[model samples]
Target: MTDLHEALRRGRARARYSQDDVGAALGVSRAMVSYWEAGSRAPNDRQLSALARLYGITPADLAEGRDVEPEEIDLAGMLLRADEEIDPGAAPGIREFVDFLQRYAELADLLGIPIRGLAQSPFVHRAKFVQKDDVRRKAEEVRSLVGLGTGPIRDLDPVCELLGITVYRAPLGADLRHAPSGAFLNHPEVGFSILVNLDMTPGRRRFTAAHELAHALFHSNETNRVVSNGRGPRESFADAFAGEFLMPSEGVRRFVEEVGIPPRIVDATDAIHIQRYFGVSWPTALVRLRQMKVVTADTYRELKHSVRPVSLARSLGYSIHPEEYEQDAGLWTIHRFPRPFLRMLRTAVIAELMSPPTAASFAGVAVPDIVQILGRPHGNAEQEQPQVDTEFVEFEATGVI
Candidate 1:
């Protein structure tokens, strides 16, 4: 017989929740939760139901350790590589990230989010080698599909969501020096997904998303995985795709003409102007300009050696928020899972198939934050007034605790 206690332990870990958390939600002591998992005791019917809800699994499945049959997808060839050598120490963390992706994919399948965006994937001839014209054409097609209309993509997250591609901003951790900027997975069951390291500059994050999108559309189906470290043929192609996707040649030229920057950029301010308009980094915008022949080779090199773009932008009177210059706040919806997945989680919670703590774990937020996310009233006004009054009286009698 399958060990229900072992199953319970595994389920809780998979959901990223602690024993104490589960116990508190169930109004039981931590010792009871431990006993149930240690096989010294079994949960009764009510406890079982709550446990299943907390784990986002069926009670029968929880008892039997019934997992979705593991699907065969190449787990190999996905990781952090520096100068062509794989970082051996990063293997475990990379694998853990992949495992988390697998769980998310299963959740996506369970939620009925269709496997899509492949037929519309912007690639020609399976992208055996990426060509400039091919990548530009493909990116334009993707832009058109997402209704971008040749303008700057102010936010690329929504377009990714629209393509049935789930994006996650994950902390890739500091263990892997020269780690991959992004990773892509084309789950046979869950469509396409991308994970961009949350530590990158916001502009870089945007670029990484587009780069991972390129891999998802072009490389993922073949090997079932792609890790982008900004090197080699596949990564090179992804970079090209990202550049074009974020900055179309025509739009860029139009902007350059509007801004009246000369063919050879003589100043950092010119690069700043273009980067801000496209929401890309100075280097990216400058490179795009170089690609479009707006700037000469000598000019590109000179600009690269000059003042940093963010500093120049700030000097030029731009507000220059940290996210725009350095790293983005990781908590924003744009930096998290796509709408369909979030919607499914909400539906699961509403149907009582998942508990609040589990949802909070998935959301990377606190329980109280989850309450707010669900749009529930914080508390009854009458119930809160007495507590506030008591707190005020106690503070007056003594002092601030």
Candidate 2:
């Protein structure tokens, strides 16, 4: 009985799976698996291999008791989103598609886990920063202090910069929005940041930034986990913040009054144009318009139903984004990670923090495919620790604090 119990506990947590759940998946009795994990016994070599495969991890990782990078602690986490039984490895056809959405949906609210948007993550802020300081309240004061005046819509970057928030552009996964730390603000430290799925529309990104900001301000005090349910009051508050922050009600009302434009403007570009003036996404603009009842529900439906998203260069001109852009040329989402992080990774060998081998472990290309999401950056940074500004990257800029 070589401390198998501790090993099993670590294994279970690392895999994000429950003991009984693993037992059911492996067609073994819960007691049997328990005994094996508890060190009273060990799984047979074949059984061990089976369990490792079930978790989509190497057997060595399980037996050696290595800390699966926070990102890999996803096997069990997937259950939150899976609408059906999740098969090991990738599934096929519609089953795979639904499973993917289910997992993504599950993560929408579980923000504490790793929903990294880029190859490298922003630096994970330590609890020490917040424990000695009253960070959350300070953050709230900071936002209120900013008192972003009521005005025409504006680009959000300046505000992010003003607040010392750094936005990270993450490759899109099934997860809709992300901020990577739980104690990101328990005391008011500053190493954590928010990461947005670059693949989302400007509309969605605008809302995501606001939602993340909410986490930084309000839930940053939550020392355990983070995730957003896109439909809750919490989310509604973020949307409201994003709307107000991007396009103040005063300005919006004034702009509409000035233009004397009523619900009849059938041109989508006009909507996009207005969003551009405000530095928001087309969808965000449309949704704002819809929310204001600026257009009839039928008109709103015509626009929402018109969106056809794609992420290839050849299709760029012919895609939904372009069509929407035709409606408003300023509709574009900005990528946050930029080229700097990769440069930091290259200097790693000099720093000696990451062994060449260790660095390769979390290499750029991994499961779920990173390239499909972030598009191609100038270069990939392998075996490098992500250096993100947690305050902004971890949550939205205008979310409830």
Candidate 3:
């Protein structure tokens, strides 16, 4: 009923989030959001703060009902600003990635995390190894600590960051498909990051991030010492971590009661409905549910293997229709370069991230390709190397061949 609630409803409407979406994001029930906006009752102080965070504004901004203006700088630009601030010794890809972390922090502000300071504050010692001093009980305790209430959190990035887990994307162009998607390292220097291939499917991305977060807290930094990225005891531990993080037994029971999912419906098509409501893949959701003893083991296995892999792309509107690739140039006809990569590449050139002739040595990457994508920003092409000294002088970056 308050102006603050009205402004929040408007902001989420512009962002095109469903009623359920506003609820999931603000950590409230859909019924509550509707009630508040309909003038039935106002959100409590905590929910009001959550709404302000979800809308990326101050409580005052929402209370005053100010128009939420679009930010001029995209996340990519904000990343470039981060690049300008951090040490240039970081690999170009790493630099861009760190830029993304800074932006992720900004997004956390929107997703209702009380994030403070820059780049996740290398100082926050929140991540802990899963203490199997009593495995199930430990997981239950974590569930209570983070307050993973009854809401379904489909996106995993915000969840991990909220838990103070670092998620890194490798740009080494390594054979990612063959390589394992999750790894954990408990080193003090690097701290914790669950490295993942950014280009993977959403479900796998979510699962892998959770798996790696387990390693950050449980396993050694060395990937192969006890458990390789492949299946092993380590995988089991990580699996436990994912299970605990994704679905808490008692919490899930509360959710089922709220939605009224019947026992008979639990294994049929209704299985996927419940899974989807949690924003997790059917199998993962069902298994985690069973693991936490929310359902019988027999029911869990039955639901887990009964169905086939459903392509979520179509449901999510990511599927291309016939008109999608209709252009003569084919799919991805328009090539918009990543702004952070471009500037960082330029800075790398100036700092000698590569040798003077590294362009020619750039494996499969072509010189003209760099020039083309990079707007041909360097000096005259008349000279063989095209004077890069000025660029190096400006950025003051250095690298060896």
Clashes of each: 0, 44, 3
Ranking of candidates on TM-score, top first: 1, 2, 3
**Best model number under lDDT:** 1
My TM-score estimates for the predictions, one after another, are 0.66, 0.42, 0.42
Over 4 Å off in model 2, which ranges?
1-144, 152-154, 172-192, 223-225, 263-270, 305-335, 338-401
Tens-digit lDDT track for model 1 on 157-193?
7788788787776655443356667787654445577
Q: Give the distance in Å from residue 23's predicted Cα in candidate 1 to where it truly belongs.
A: 48
- Tens digits of per-residue lDDT, candidate 3, 53-135, equal 65556677777778766222122222223223222222354444444444434334333444332122222222333354344
For model 2 the local lDDT of residue 36 reads 79
lDDT of 2: 0.46
Q: How close is candidate 2 to the true structure, as a TM-score?
A: 0.42
- C-alpha lDDT score of every prediction, in listed order: 0.70, 0.46, 0.50
Winner on lDDT between 2 and 3 is: 3
User: Candidate 1: minimum summed lDDT over ten consecutive residues — where?
Assistant: 69-78
| TM-score, candidate number 1 | 0.66
lDDT of 2 by residue, 1-401 (tens): 22445656666554445566667667898888778766888887788777767655577766766555422333223322332322222222222222332333233223223332222122233232242123323333434556665554355544554554445443333333332111111111122244454445556665677666655554433221233445445445545555555655456667767766554556665565566556566567777777666777888888777744232222433224454343232222222432223233334423565444543333333322233133334344432225434555556666735
How big is the positional error of residue 223 in model 3, measured in Å on the Cα after superposition? 9.0
